[model samples]
Target: MDQPWLKALHVAAVLLFAGGLLAQSLAVAAALRNDISPGVLARLRQWDQRVTVPALLTAWAFGIATALDNGWFGAGWLSAKLLLVVALTGLHGLQAGALRRLAFQAGRPPRGLGRAPAAVALALAAIAVLAVAKPF
Candidate 1:
């Protein structure tokens, strides 16, 4: 409700989203060895819908509102952080689409999907540093 609480919620959501992505990525990568298992994909679907999607939405909503409320748009640090966040969000989209394909279309995850977890981890690290250091 309040700004501080909202910011806390945003952080929590980001953490949950990141953790879910890592878990899903691991599941997907493992699934590639023997084709996507229906059970695993089913679990992934539930996790994404129940946790990842909501967390992503909540993070963005609270983050955008906080930035606007504080008028930090013009700051160099904020801009850098936003850019990284955008990249991470794009990764989220890719992961979600892959999950859907595996869940519905019985698609095999491409070999390239294996690299996603690493990307997310690195992006999250960079975003954390930018947020903490606020370096230009």
Candidate 2:
């Protein structure tokens, strides 16, 4: 049996990770609009590198561990959740790369990158609903 505390921790981490991604998306959207201060953009890049990256790694570790412990392989819903997680992970990578370019390169913000966050956000919302409903 999985420890209750471990399950709780995993859920909390998931919420934090998802919420952080949403917040980061909004921040990127804001930055994309109108000229933002160099300091602000630089700080956002730094935060992504220093904080968001680590948090995402930790969240994935915990989430995967919890799923495994809960017999995720036996559940269709769990499999779907894992797939969505992978998609979100890809989006996270794209976001990180975009931030790096925005901070250091003089490029056109990498065309179509802006769509990733919204896509991930929608996927996440669907994932959340699936998790809650477990309608598999």
Candidate 3:
């Protein structure tokens, strides 16, 4: 399709993916303190599997499409943005694993996971700057 629409979809998908990761991060952090019900964790897992995962995949697909369409493959800013996106994606996987462990097994989340939300925020901010400014 058109470049503008493609970019818009990519942005929308990224927003959804980022929102999901933030929500998951908070939930995992909460699990570290209070006892979140297994049912709630299950619901979160369902949401992650159905909505968040798809959104992440969509974001990747549309992002690559936009980059190809714009011939931005070699841009330094794009590379930096992609690195942040990969980090976010990996963070999502870790969060999902933590949620599963919390739901099925007993114990606190892995150390340092409580700080993931802030990290996600920072990465997202950096990504936004790179995307908007394209500053190398």
Instruction: Please tell me which predicted candidate would have the highest lDDT against the true structure.
Output: 3
Task: For model 3, state the Cα shift of residue 127 in Å.
Answer: 0.7
> Ranking by lDDT, best first?
3, 1, 2
Model 3 spans with C-alpha error above 4 angstroms: none
> Between which residue pairs do clashes occur in model 1?
none
Give stretches of model 1 more than 4 Å off. Answer: none
Flag clash pairs in model 2. none
* Model 3, global lDDT: 0.91
TM-score of each: 0.87, 0.82, 0.95
lDDT of 2 by residue, 59-115 (tens): 777777776776666688878887898888787776766666667755545546557
lDDT digits (tens) for residues 4-111 of candidate 1: 987888899999988888888777677667655788788888988999989988899998888887787898988888888888777777777777787776677778
Per-residue lDDT of 1-136 in model 3, one digit per residue for the tens? Answer: 9989999999999998888899899899888887578788899899999989999999999999999999999999999999999889998998998898788786678878989989999999999999999998
Say which prediction, candidate 1 or candidate 2, comes out ahead on TM-score. 1
Which stretches of candidate 2 lie above 4 Å from their native place? none
